[model samples]
Target chain A: MTSPLVTVTDLKVHFPIKKGILAKTVGHVYAVDGISFDIMPGETIGIVGESGCGKTTAGMAMVQLTPVTSGAVLWKGRDMAEMTRSELRALRREMQLIFQDPYSSLNPRMTVRQILSDPMDVHGLFTGHQRKERIDFLLDTVGLSPGQADLYPHEFSGGQRQRIGIARALALDPCLIIGDEPVSALDVSIQAQIINLLKRLKRDFNLSLIIISHDLAVVEYICDRIIVMYLGKIVEAADYASLYKNPRHPYTRTLMSAIPVPDPARRTRRIILKGDVPSPISPPDGCRFHTRCPDRMEICHKQEPAMRRFGNRHTAACHLYTDEQAEPVENKPKAKEKIS
Target chain B: MDQKTQASILSIQNLKTHFFSRKGVARAVDGVSFDLIPGQVLGIVGESGCGKSVTAQSVMGLVPNPPGKVVGGKIFFHHRDLLTLTVQELRKIRGAGIAMIFQEPMTSLNPVYTIGNQISEMFRLHKKLGKKQALAAAIDMLERVQIPSPHKRVHEYPHQLSGGMRQRAMIAMAMSCNPEILIADEPTTALDVTVQAQILDLMHRLKEEFSTAIQLITHDLGVIAEMADQVVVMYAGQVVEQARTVELFQHTLHPYTRGLLASIPVLGHRTLGKDEDLVEIKGMIPSLYDLPAGCRFSNRCPKVMDMCKNHLPDLIDMGGGHQVRCWLHTREMIS
Candidate 1:
């Protein structure tokens, strides 16, 4: 079997919390304490969580857009954390990130032609007429009119601006693209257009994608594998079918159940978890989700469960799957042991 | 299910709101109509620039002029046409009769004012209560919306509260006067799923307690399905379809509505793969200023016909209160 395109191992990103006029370090906000995942070539991996679950931080850390506090982001067997500036700069040409907000991502002053061609000029890919052709090709590739290359970013609509963003991401001819909340800002109709465009481009270019979004519907639709993050830790990771069909972790189940399905007639039972997510600065000891988890155990409060594998490449970090000898019957808890 | 028996708190008929810019007249809400019955959740679902918010604004008599005006239509709240009411008369009815909550709480709320001050102002102005009484009432309102430690939270500014708590404050302010109707425009769109669910559930509970009719305007069909009992599907500033939530989702008539239902990637079910493509409405929403002479959706509609290109179709009732604005349905009824 071929090797994976990217592998992230125990990646942690911590931001120091400062206090007073002296700006002394008080504590640290563990944005991404420790997470791990792998992205196979031509495969799409999605990381989903709420506002400050560190899904975005992990994604940024994977691409070296953010500084890693610990662990490694191995790009083709090379640890990116140890790479030199020039080496990392060269690595950036093969992997790129698309920001969430298209309204602010693109330069309002730059024309479409200039934005797409600027990257090529820096990389010294094509010169003269060849560069112009490549810019037009990138624009057309993202379903924008090549003739509109002369137009500024402001001249386009929200969806059109996103197309320009995709074009720019593809300008460097990268093999991997990490889109952070790519279609979240677009209208529903426009979201469908962009999702389709991304799918088409992924197949056509054989590009590995790591799409990070809070929208489960969009993630489930486009991604091959999914990682559920909570308070900077990965709770579950599985193939789309297995994850959606049979979510193992209590957090994963609650998150999946929370998403309102479009069909009104087919009403599914929902497990609405109460209370807000705990502050990441001081995440709950043991299992971070034990605070709001419905099927939590007494042991969950004292010990953090490691990632345990189920069948079909599905894995969940939960105490319910602790007993190895017990047959995982839909992976439900066996008994309610009283807390000491 | 007789419409006469079930009284409507707010009724809009052929509402045409246009934004008159220097370039042209942008018909934002073009001949749209809907009725919100008391205690019922009437969702108006559409994409951006589809006039769902404009319809809500029209009901509130809050359409900014010089650029926008309600060119034609009647917004009847409690059998009285709101358009004909004097500004002073509307002022009396604004919070007491009809209340509204906008999408962005940070922008909608006054930054300088404390949560208590902002909420108390509602009671002070509408209820004609004294300062101390209004402040006490505001704390009560905050507590009702499930804001923990209302006393402390009331003193805090909008920035001090989290997104969910801020929305709770907004809801508390809107419901302070016990208005008969509430127009919530994308109330939970800016929030996370957990918080969205919390707010949606809170709204549902509030509706049960107050029996206040809600005009929920959003682009999310999933939220609409979860909350709305009746739905209005709008396109290009026009009502393309209207029906019971279950009926509309089960048997969508308009091609545009069908495309919309097909386009969304639902959780727990996904058929679109590497080989298959998701169904998408072909083109962008037509320019509101230069809308199609016929059906506004004709340009992007996959099932477009020759008749759809030349003449606009009426929103004909197809029995059981399900209305569809399409030549195919209208032609079928005629035949």
Candidate 2:
């Protein structure tokens, strides 16, 4: 990786819980606890996890939208945490974030013209006439008509609003774009359109994209590599082909199996996980997934496993895969259980 | 599971549920028709504005009146025409004969009331059970739905419970009356994958244990494939394709169905390859307020013919009870 665009080193973000009356500091919600990854230039990396897994927190923390408790996020080999106000402001122009729900993320009062130009205005990039021209270019780039720029977000449909959101993200000519569940809120038919638009934009701009979504299929389709997070930690990180072919982590396996295959006849026996994700406030001791993992060993409840590397660029955090003294359970295909 | 052999538990005949808003008349469920078999899961699959949820609401008699109305057609439940029934008569059948479970567990459950009170209300109203008996029955129902520590959980409010547990409690309340049909409208859509799997498994087990006909409505094809015995593919509030689950997947007749299946990025080795764009349906779903004259999907249909643009096609019954509504298929039938 020739000087990665961004590198996150052992990042941890803990949100403090405040109680009644005195507003006393209670326990902390370990949102993005000790996670690390790198984004190479123009590469699309996907971060996937269910609700409360801290994928969103990690994405926001990377962009400096959320305050980080500890560790460093290096933007082009420079520590972003240490950057001064002026430096951080300059960096913001090259990095951007797109939210899941376009309806809520976008301001209803602002017209599409204002929404796209305001970001550039904040950065002091283009002014007045130049900004207007730039906004038109952006609208056209996102497949929306230049005339529609005068209308408010309410005037457009869910799909068009998302396009507007995308146009706003692209306004500053950002090198990196973080889409947190970007297409999840959109309808099935419209989702594909937005996804295709994202893919095309990424290619056209040579942009480094970080797509965070719970939908495995969506991630697999677009992302060159995927990072699977479980309880504020990355359980597995692998390239698309390797991850889909041989997923090592029990949680990842369960998640992959849980996805409803469109074709009924090709349905695989689902490894139905037993329970919900343990509360993030006080996550399970040792391995966070031990309580739900079917193939759990004694060590999983006592010690957290390190993320070990496998076939080229593939890594998984599971005792089963780690080179440890404990007898490893032979990974075998489970008996086919009928869904009906 | 032959359609003719299995007795139709609930039959919908050309049901037209239209919403009369100030803007225009949105034909949410325009001439949609399907039959649910006893103890069988019938999946209604469509994207958001395609009227899958409205169809479920129409069946439950829960569609809001002033703006909404079942303008035309018949809904036969146990050979009784539900459309003709009065509000009071429909109320009797709601919890006891047919139950409904919504997508958002939080909204469906009352935040102020305890789980026990909510569940017991069903038994009290439908089964005529007293407070003591109703509470006991509610706890039993909670246990049946596999909500851990039913005794403690029953006393807890909805806010105290997690997303999965809240849905489980909702299911418990739905099953408290032991209704003949359960209309689960995107029941697990709001939960996590693991939680979704658990809820789906619970629904499957309950169907087997109680022999309750389930009308599962969702946009997820994967959910439809796993749970449905039969599927009705709707487009613009109309049944585009209806067939047995296996047959539907194997021989997908409708172009719209094919497009939907292709649009989704499948896991493992599948159709889409590297560097290939997903086959998207060209345009947006036709506006229900003013649908195209011919086929609802004709505007975006790849194999659209001249007749498709001019005249609407009827649902033509192919062999083995597989029906497809398209000019191409109907033309083939005519030939």
Q: How does each model score on TM-score? A: 0.95, 0.95
For residues A1-340, could you state the per-residue lDDT of candidate 1 as single tens digits? 8898899999899999999999999999999988988889999999999989999999888888888999999999888888999998888889987888898999999999888887888788878889888987898899988899999998888889999999999999899999999999988788899999999999999999999999877898888999999999999999988888888888888888888878787666677766788889999999999888888777888999988888867888988875573235364556855443
The local distance difference test score of each candidate is 0.89, 0.90
Give the per-residue lDDT of model 2 (tens digit) for B50-157. 999988888888899989999999888877889889999999999899999999999999999999999999989988999999999999999999988899999999
Q: Where does candidate 1 stray beyond 4 Å?
A: A323-340, B1-6, B271-275
**Clash count list over all predictions:** 0, 0
**Candidate 1 clashing pairs, residues 3+ apart or interchain:** none
- Two-chain DockQ for model 1: 0.66
Docking class of 2: medium
Which 10 consecutive residues of model 1 chain A have the lowest summed lDDT?
A325-334
